[model samples]
Target: MLQGEEASFFVLCDGKTALPLGTAQDHKRVGEGDTGPNTGGMGAYSPAPVLSEAVQERAMERIVRPTLREMSRRGMPFQGVLYAGLMIENGEPRLIEYNVRFGDPEAQVLMMRLGGQVLDLIQAAAEGRLDEVSVAWADDHALTVVLAARGYPGRVETGVPIRGTEGLPRSSVQMLFHAGTALQDGTLVAAGGRVLNATARGTTLQEARDRAYALVDAIDAPGLFCRRDIGWRALGPVQDAPATSQPT
Candidate 1:
């Protein structure tokens, strides 16, 4: 079988300019090591190493920019976030799909890295001021592990109470984003397939992975579980960490 890793690239557009924000990669399957059935996204990390600076430039030049030019040429100039899902092999990028909105788990990690500046970037892109603004990226990494209902990407138990969210770390380096949650009888409960995102940022990928997993272990959602090896592709395999979906 052909081998490659997928990378998610974000471009801010305003029908006049397209600006590349950065790259991220996400795990799509419901199980560990990228096995099992495909889901929206199980986890994600930003600043994918496989998409090096040189590779990103090539992708922009050969793929994204040309597509934008074509859209403009066809009198359908696009605005808003253009998320490109690209498969990288031998440092070359191949388009998998294009999403006009921010990706799910991918956006989770990217936002963890981008912080409040993302709002400014979006506003600038919407106002056609992309040329005047620039993304200020930190020299760090972010990873997010998605907590889904026990039987995700298929049938899932709904209305399952989710606890310990308030207890999870929330700071400049750690965060918890509720994706498929609802308030019922004054209780936070799982209302969809993917429920929560335990995200963290650190100086290195390993640190981010460790911190994210730390939140996963502390969540008291009996019906939710997450992959333990979220950054395995970038960080390589490890002997530690719990099994995927080990009951909380």
Candidate 2:
């Protein structure tokens, strides 16, 4: 098995031009430090340190451009978000998959950074005018920790009342997003394996992570769980060794 960090890059394409929108790394495993069984995604952070501007540019020139070229050659020019899932080892990127939509928790972190830039990008791409518009991303980092039901990626106990959603921070820097939730009898309850997303942005990845964790800790959902190290890979070092993660 090839062991390395995983990342995904997002781009808005109009068959003639591809507009990049940065990248993100996600925690795939259900436990800390990439331990336990693999899950869809436990948490995520944006501006993955591994996918630097140089690497992103290389990916665009090498991967994204070629793929779009091939699609056009086949008379199927892509005209929307083109997502690339990659495994990076020794600073070289290897393709894991290609998605036409946003990556899971990876999208959460990027959207936190992108904000309303999404609408503009989508409109431009849909109209085949991507070159006419540009994405103005903030020089900031974002982290999102998924709050899952106690037994996620397995048998999950649902209908558990979730508290602490009231009076929480909901600003550009910090917020909570509900996923698999339902309101019964005027009470919010967990309705699926993954429940909420505690997300935040900051000047640095560490600061965003701290703010996200604070939001996680404020929740009173006894049936929920979250991974503590969302940005471990980007932050450098695990304990004795370097951190490796995925988009996972």
User: Residue-wise lDDT of candidate 2 within 1-248, one digit each (tens)?
Assistant: 66777788888888889999779888888977788898888988888888988788878888889999999999999988889998888777778889998888888888889898788888888888888888787889999999898778788989999998897999999989888999989999999988899999999888998899889888888878877777887776445321222112
- Candidate 2's TM-score reads 0.93
Off by over 4 Å in 2: 236-248
The best candidate in terms of lDDT: 1
Worst 10 residues of 2 by lDDT: 239-248
